[model samples]
Target: MNKKREIQSSVKDESLIEKRRAQMIRGAVTLFKQKGFHRTTTREIAKAAGFSIGTLYEYIRTKEDVLYLVCDSIYDEVHARLESLDIEKGSLEVLVTALEHYYGLIDDMQDEFVVMYQESKSLPKDALQYVLKKELEMVALFERLLTECRESGELKMTPKEIKLAAHHLFVQGQMWAFRRWALRDFTISEFIQTQTNFLLQGMAGEKISTQGAK
Candidate 1:
């Protein structure tokens, strides 16, 4: 998803660039959580990373580059953890477990999600498009699961319906973050249980009981 993010810098040492960027990203995430990307200055990010402004510029071109780095890192973490699940099983049970696992990850990284939602518009057009493309890949995971369900005759839905179902699954997972403040009384497990039930029943006649899906 972070393909070709060649952030131009005069630094020629690739290893040092990676190390410095990682430090910058960690520091930037903390700062972004406290003061949004819009409010943060390049000097502040440099100070947070324990570097001088000149050193910070060695890895990043501008403050927007750091924002892109932070967002890219978050998505990378999300994708890595999500890919660890038995997603290849392509069953309702697998999908349920994946959803529950993802909900947990989102809850754990709520601050990062909040920052991303509030500041992603600050990303450059190319960076925003890259992020959106990665998101589409995540939604496609659900589409694959639905296709397998259809093949197994566990659900009956048309291609267009399957496409919409994929989108629903992705958006619902995101809604947990987007609406979390308004739904503070709700737990991630409850969100997973209720939303999974809704999707399962809506897609098929049977409600998937993820109680045994753990």
Candidate 2:
């Protein structure tokens, strides 16, 4: 009975520890997003998390470790969302719609997403590389979608062109987050619709009606 009770108590302690760690990560993300990586301190994180500095250190070794934890958490959320998407549907329009949905999701996760986007370089070497690898995987997903669109004759671009196009689209999508100050007046759906229309029009090889196109 004594041994069984000890095991149960350990499990409960571990569970509480994880809960506290999660709280710290959440606080770190908010502070890092607001004040940047170099400016935010462990004391700020601890206070935000309602924990002591010693307690914060129990879960994370350094400020860099907290950055890694915050980045990894955001990456996990993005990866899970992308992985669950059904990419085999409808047409290029459908894919564009899905991309817009992803943009909206990121917008909703602004604090975490912004931290991951702007403070990635603050992570230690290995942690930075790990986060970058996940980012590359996300980019590859867009590349794969473009390749599919090309193979299905939904797009008229060559393989290299398709890759370049995907890169541009990804960059453009990121602008919604990175340039939110400039884009603050636009709704996510409006931005998505306008951007998708521009991309689709370009992909269709339609002639521009601009003054120089005469």
Candidate 3:
């Protein structure tokens, strides 16, 4: 995915700009979750951020800019966290760990994510495209991980299988968040356990039980 777009700012200190925008994103996520994008106003975002309306405007030009920043920050956070995983071994155990890690991260950000999915349609066309591109990059992460497993002989997928499986894994992780209310009966641990087992059984071509997953 492309690097974050340079939002014009009056502030000169790059570090300060990042710091303020981070605050704005945090504040905006809260409001978006509570009141949604259409109902939330820039003044409310400024108040939630513990800053003045004028200061908020110093970093972003519009409320839409704040929304774009929130979506951008979320994808960046997910990418950074996934990059921190040590999954190079490419074993079944490593694969299970990676899935669990990803699903857990998704659960952790369920609200912001749901907001992103629901409100991103309001984003400008170019901003929406950038967000969608970031999503493909996430899918690529899973594909690369699966490729590693295949090379190590822990998986038996063809290239097409690897690509589709990667999309499956990525979307399924988000499914847990997007369908949280319908799945309230299942704990995160149970959800992860069942999904991991289901995925591994298909990918490994054998029933590899993760009995200890719960």
Best by the TM-score measure: 3
**Candidate 3 Cα errors over 4 Å, as ranges:** 86-89, 211-214
User: Model 1: per-residue lDDT, tens digit, 1-214?
Assistant: 4475678888999999889999898788788988888788889889989999999988889898988877777678778767876655677777787777777778877767777778889999998999878778888878988888788778899999999998988768778877888987778788888888988888998776878676
1-214 in candidate 3: lDDT tens per residue?
6877668899999999999998998899989989999999999999999999999999999998998998887788787777776656566666677788778878888877888998999999888999999989988888888989999888998999999999998888888878899998999988998888888788898878776642
Regions of candidate 2 where Cα sits further than 4 Å from its true position: 1-18, 88-90, 206-214
Q: What TM-score do all the candidates reach, one by one?
A: 0.85, 0.80, 0.89
Clashes of each: 0, 0, 0
lDDT of 2 at 180: 83
What TM-score should be assigned to candidate 3?
0.89
Clashing pairs in 2: none
RMSD of 1: 2.4
- Sequence-dependent TM-score of model 1: 0.85
Is candidate 1 or 2 superior in TM-score? 1
